[model samples]
Target: MSNISAAIPPVRWGILATGKIAALFAADLALVEDAELAAVGSRSIESARRFADTHSSGARAYGSYAELAADPDVDVVYVATPHGRHVEDVMTCFEAGKAVLCEKALTLNADDGSTLIEEARHRGVFFAEAMWMRCNPNIRKIQDMVAAGSCGTVGQVRAELGFVAKPDIARLWDPELGASSLLDVGIYPLTFTNLILGEPTHIVAAGIKSDRGIDVSGGATLTYTSGAVASIAWTQMAWSDNRAAVSGDGGRIEIAPRFHETTGFSHARNWELDEFAEPVLGRGYAHEIIEVNECLRAGRTESALLPLDGTLEIMRQIDEIRLQIG
Candidate 1:
């Protein structure tokens, strides 16, 4: 940490949207001792004011994202806009010389994601995808254990996430918003598998598309060079168990329901079972906030836990899956 970093006790945050996900992140930001929800921006001043009043009384509200990005008091801006608008929103922040933490599925496609990341690097601005699950303490613990051979020679991984999204939710059904179950819910399971098994050598996928041509439900089987296999699924048409598990020759680790945000898991081996648990801070979003704060304070450009390369890789994988299913 620099002297300036040490001088500032709390890192200031600016939220770029006032949607549900943005609200969830703002609420979680309150839980971090070293973070401050300093500002919020929306296309409408009323919406921004409402969000500020509801989430943080002292936070400033901006009528436009450009104004928020231009605020000198804000050390970093969280881009919570829709996936389709990520490139434009993120570029605005970058141009203003502000660090950014954008929501997952960084962009609608790998090419756009690459462009944004390259621009961030060229500008020497800090950037990260808000893949909060990768920042979850419990999930990190699982990664360490698996790397330590706790799940020896892992052979198979199974994961799924889904919810019944109605038509009223335009973002979930509108192709113009870059809506797709794969980009929304499916990214979780795909990321989970990649974290454990590395990149896949082959992928076979099939999906059911809505009238607007967006995938509403899908499943993919990924095969790795080590002969490990992963079966992952996602849907926006119905509810799913939202569970995940990893099996190997030695044992199996099962994450509880809503696995991406799970606080615990069970490891079974030799007719015995052991459990591991960790505290999830404020709906599991605080961890990522903390990570960004630490990185900013330390003058780091990207997170090692959720690296830009990793995010780009996932986007490429999704692109491939979409191509196959289409």
Candidate 2:
């Protein structure tokens, strides 16, 4: 824990998976003033116990997700399973009456995303896909500026993300597991364009599929109703610039490479450029953790900043892109 955010009462959290992402989130949750890592769950009781001991003292350890979800002390559950198991894992939490903030690319496909959101709505529980970028303060500032026409008449956008996947990374290259560069890394750039430009009127995409048939690299062009267009690309074979930009008639906003977790962006207007940086709380994960806490505290089932509708729309677009690439 670094410095605690003031006045937010503790919200006990149960993590429903013992994975790398689970550990990262558990550490960040400690930085939140209102967050308590109350429980951890894994297929093996010993695994859960080990994770809890490392992340949260006194946190209960459950041998199964069902037990974790049923833990009465837990206020919410964070699903950190791989994409293939998202639906089943999320259902466990939802049906258990626990609020949830599941890791993103919320599900393997659009229908699943819709199904999850519908269930959440029906359950009247606080639910959110952990698309943490939407909660970054500087990203929010750029969004505000773009909406206010700071980047006048935004005409075009571009974003790219790429990284090499080790052969041992089972989830990155396994077709049966819904492995694809688009879902794993491309979602960030796709969501970036979608946030700034809204839904696309026309979407054109292409992919370089691997021997196993999952996309290893790809690109997309999205044209919006306002004539604004976006170009995005991703690859799992090698690292690229990983940069994003939004250009308008007046100027452009340049997001630093690896923009998804970036601290700031540069904007130029009327031939002058200015840089803005808003250092996020705790590796940029605390913002979303706080957002979830706030939503639960306010008795809200949905977040206006990261709405379910948007997640579904992106999943739909992803479906279309994958089909085109195939």
Best model number under TM-score? 1
Give the distance in Å from residue 303's predicted Cα in candidate 1 to where it truly belongs: 0.4
Best by lDDT: 1
Q: Against the unseen true structure, what C-alpha lDDT does each candidate score? A: 0.94, 0.91
**Model 1's lDDT to the true fold?**
0.94
Stretches of candidate 2 above 4 Å error? Answer: 2-9
Model 1 off-target regions past 4 Å?
1-7
Query: How many residue pairs collide in each prediction?
Result: 0, 0
